[model samples]
Target: MTARVLLVTSEAVPLVKTGGLADVITALAQALRQQGVDATVMMPGYPAAIENACNLKQAGNLPELPGGPGTILHGVMPGSDVPVVLLKTERFDQRTANPYVDENGAEFDDNALCFGSLAHAAVSICAGETDLPVPHVVHANDWHAGLVPALLRMKGITGVGTLLTIHNLAFQGNFAMSAAADLAIPDSMLTPDQFEFWGKMSFLKAGILYADRISTVSRSYANEILTPRFGHGFDGLLGARREALVAIPNGVDTGAWDPASDRLTVRHFSLNDMRGKSGCKRDLQQLFGLPVDPFAPVLAIGSRITHQKMADVAIDALPGVLERFPRAQLIVLGRGDHAYEQAFLGMAERFPGRVAIHIGYDERRAHALHAGADMLLHGTRFEPFGLTPLYSMRYGTIPIASRVGGMIDSIVDAGLQGTIPDDASGILFDGEQAQDMVAAISRAFELYARPNEWHLMQRNAMSADFSWSGPAEQYIGVYREIAPVEAQALFDERSAAVNDSVNLPADEEAAEAAAMPEYMTA
Candidate 1:
């Protein structure tokens, strides 16, 4: 009686990953299975995914798409038992490099055709055109899979509910209206009420219009998108479907992110004994070629270098921070926005050993930074749901973040009155100016001078739970709301049993955590 769900996404961790979306899809699917739901992941067969898959077998051939027929391959996700379906076609097979962009950082020219075929195949499978079981719900993530819901409705496929999750509204999949014929979208469905957005065909708009439900990554983000400031021109459309919109904050894989067991770090440590953190600090300083001064506060940046991420603000605030704390060092790791990249490189050059910059991403280095650094610097203008801050907090590294997006939901600012009775995880500052970040850094330095208070804050951060159990329960509730009566009863019974087995703290901390945000807790 369990409702079957097909998680349609463009990327998934271990197989392919471009951002946090990959991690969310993989972890959420696994969490759903633990909650007694039958979940499967469906994605295009990029070269990396095909190469990494084990026990792969040909499932069947899909119905003719705009480009040609696609062959479906079945395999299990590398580290888990979750089943995965890989759509194999000429277009997807040709994408040997990055899934969405080319070496030059430009989106592939045939992106519309590439993703359109994925959606068409999803609809065909759900409509009984394939040999696979029909999913009770088709859960699509981001613009890459946005066309699934629209195609489902256009084909008049019944009994299949669609849930579209908007990870970031800024990257809407927009293409010229003339490409509709190439994408095989019917002309009748091209009105402003459907896929049309300001005379252009918007794949994201189609999903928002046709999906049975829509979700954002965080509660504050869900509310922010309803206004003109954060909607990116889709505010009015999303406002019309306000009732269907919900927020399910992203969660961290505690097992994979635990500081006690993480193999990526040089030394393992926990709240019980933080001596290993000093060893990790020395290792990080050695790795980055900075002075191995354990007392010098290490501030790390592990986010993409982009304007929205406020990488410029982080860079601009460094000089003032260095002037105040002469021994402070900064280590930056991530790649994006050539301008920001050059700016960071320039900073590293200007301040020989104190500043270190890595132009690209390395999973091991990121984990090391989170475990080794004293504080994580995140100055984002707008973020849907950032996973790095959560990861950092779990490692007992305090976050110095801007007061926006998921940062507001996740980090409990020490300065915020009445937020927590005796604990604070991080520091928060408002505005997008460099001066704002400098002030926040100044406050962080002042707190760092008091080891007792700083260690107490670290304990609070390490004790915080950002696991998937709560988010999985929330998602199950959404599924039950759209599922049949029999399925609803089955879900309710399973959920009750699951909730009973979970042991949450029975003190004021639990109550305060629960009251923080709807998406942060059950």
Candidate 2:
């Protein structure tokens, strides 16, 4: 009696990844399976996915989509028990290094059609037109799978609930209205209320309009999207569906991210032991070619270099910070925005040995940064639910983050609160200005000078739980709310069994926390 869910997404970790969406989809699917929900992920068969998948077999063949016929392949996600259905078609098979963008950094010309084919396949499977098992709910993630809900409704399909989760509202899949026929979108459903957004066909608007329930990665983001600032031009439509919207914050995989067992880092350390961290710190300095000063705080930035991430602010503040603390070293890893890249490279030139910048992302180095750095610098103007700060905290690294989105939800600002309590996890600045960042870095330096206070905050961060167990349970509650009566009974039975098996200390608290972050509650 398991409530089967078809998780429609563009990417999954270990198979394909360009951003946090891949990690979120894979982890959520795996966690849902652990809780007795039959969650299966459905994604386009990019060459990387097909190359890396395990136990791959032909599930079935799909009817001709706008692109062409596709062969559905079933496989288990590498290193996890979660089942994955890959839609293999020439449209997806020929994708460049990045799924959405090509070598020239331009989006693929047929991206709308390529992702539309993915949505069509998902809707077909949910309607029991494929060899795959019919899902009780079709949960679509982001714009790539956004067309599923609208297509289902347009085709008059029923009995399956649709849930659309907006990971980031900034990247709406908007295409030329003339390409509607190429995407196989019906003319009847092209009105402003459905898929049309300012004379363009929008895949994201379709999902938001037709899905039974809408959710965002964090509670603050869900509330933020109701206004013009965060809504990305869909505030009015989102406001109309306010009652249907829910905010379920994403969670980290404790087993995969555990500092003790992580194979990516040079040295593994836990909360109890303090010796290994120093070893890691030295190793990180050597890796980045920075002067090995154990006393000099190492600040790391592991995010995309983009305007949204406020990388410009960090760039502008670095000179003042280095001047204030002569021995401070900064290490940056990520690639985005050519302007930011040039700016960071210029900063590295200005302060050789003190600043190390890597233009592209390296997973091992990111893990090392989290494990070895004394502090993580996350200065974002807007973030949906950042996984970097969560990873940093788990590695016992204090985060100096902007007070926005998930950063506000997870990090208790020691600087703002004026006390280093047991729960004080990081330093939070109020704005994206360079001066604000300077003040936050200064506060970080102040806390670093007080070893006892700094250690307390690190312990608080390490002790805090940000695992998938909490978020999975909240998702189950959403499933129960939208699922049929029989499915609800099944969910109740599974919830009891899961609770009995997992011995979770904060299951009840997590369930309550899903409604709203504790800080927001009156």
Candidate number of the best TM-score: 2
How far residue 388's Cα lies from its native spot in candidate 1, in Å, is: 0.7
Supply candidate 1's per-residue lDDT for 344: 93
**lDDT, model 1, position 214:** 92
lDDT of 2 by residue, 110-132 (tens): 99888999998887887777788
TM-score, candidate number 2: 0.93
Residues 143-217 of candidate 1: C-alpha lDDT, one tens digit per residue: 989999888877788678788999999989998898799877889889877789988899999999988889888
Worst 10 residues of 1 by lDDT: 496-505
Give lDDT for model 2: 0.85
For model 1, what is the error of residue 280's alpha carbon versus the real structure, in angstroms, after optimal superposition?
1.8
